[model samples]
Target: MTQPPLTTNQDLDSARLREAFGVFPSGVVAVAAIVDGAPIGLAASSFTSVSLEPPLVSFSIAATSKTWPTLRRCDHVGVTILREDHGEVCRQLAGPVDHRFDGLTCSVTGQGALTLDDGVAQFDCTIHEEVQAGDHVIVLLQLHAVAHAEASMPLIFHRSGFGRLSASA
Candidate 1:
């Protein structure tokens, strides 16, 4: 018996690809879902807004993550726009979690989905669709409710660390 050789795109080193992408600054987000009376959330910098006519949003989740499978099966989910004050919360949610929402301020919708408090913006959504995208799932959502917190600066991500939008930018 012989072991199979590893393969990858010839022009791309995974580490360098990640590093280059890291240079592209992104906003911090908390994608959350409630299961069995507990909230499952993860800090993600890959979130993007897809549309506005009918209102839509999207976020990517690693396909290997068991947490996302649970979230996928959830009836509703929340996308929280983390503010500059949420750097620690971003770290907490991104960490290994037997309990991610420990003592975090949150509330539920009429459908029993979790929502974050004091975020710059919060979105309550129903999973509209999901599609495979390389090693991640691109999750599309139907916007149900939205809230805005003015006077809040955006939390940010760049090169694997937390950041805040430049007030001067």
Candidate 2:
């Protein structure tokens, strides 16, 4: 098949950029912690493993995110890779900050890190670095602990929506 020609002179706005970026599917994760005696978090589809030598991972937060400022104050942050059935949970995390943990079972560490009990994988991490990039900040997290379920599939985010992967052949 012939590929379409790229429009070199076309302007790329935020909406167009988002639509282009969403062409690639990504796993979604919840970055959370106990703040002011309550669970606080937000869903991020940008989560990725960054390093192995020092055990690091990363996710990006928009410059306008109100939750990051609060959650970043915690000593440790819990990163939970959402399970395939966690669409509603992800929505809750992205909803009102006060109701994020409502009706959900989560585990909290002594250091204030919090993770969903039914997540596909969980990580206890601390902020290693935060680099400002364009309209977002890339947060590098140093992993102190990790856990996973052997038979769970991860939730996927694509084209501004949540989806589950089909079983492997």
Question: Which candidate ranks first by TM-score, i.e. highest?
Answer: 2
Writing each residue's lDDT as its tens digit, candidate 1 over 20-139 gives 799999998888888887778798888899989778898888888878877777888888989887888888898877767877899788676677887889899999888999998998
Give the candidate number with the greatest lDDT: 2
- Tens digits of per-residue lDDT for model 2 on 58-85? 9999999999999999999999999999
The local distance difference test score of each candidate is 0.84, 0.95
Residue ranges of candidate 1 with Cα displaced over 4 Å = 1-10
- The segments of candidate 2 whose C-alpha lies over 4 angstroms from its true place after superposition are 1-4
Error of model 1, residue 90, in angstroms: 0.7
Please give each candidate's TM-score. 0.89, 0.96
RMSD of 2: 1.3
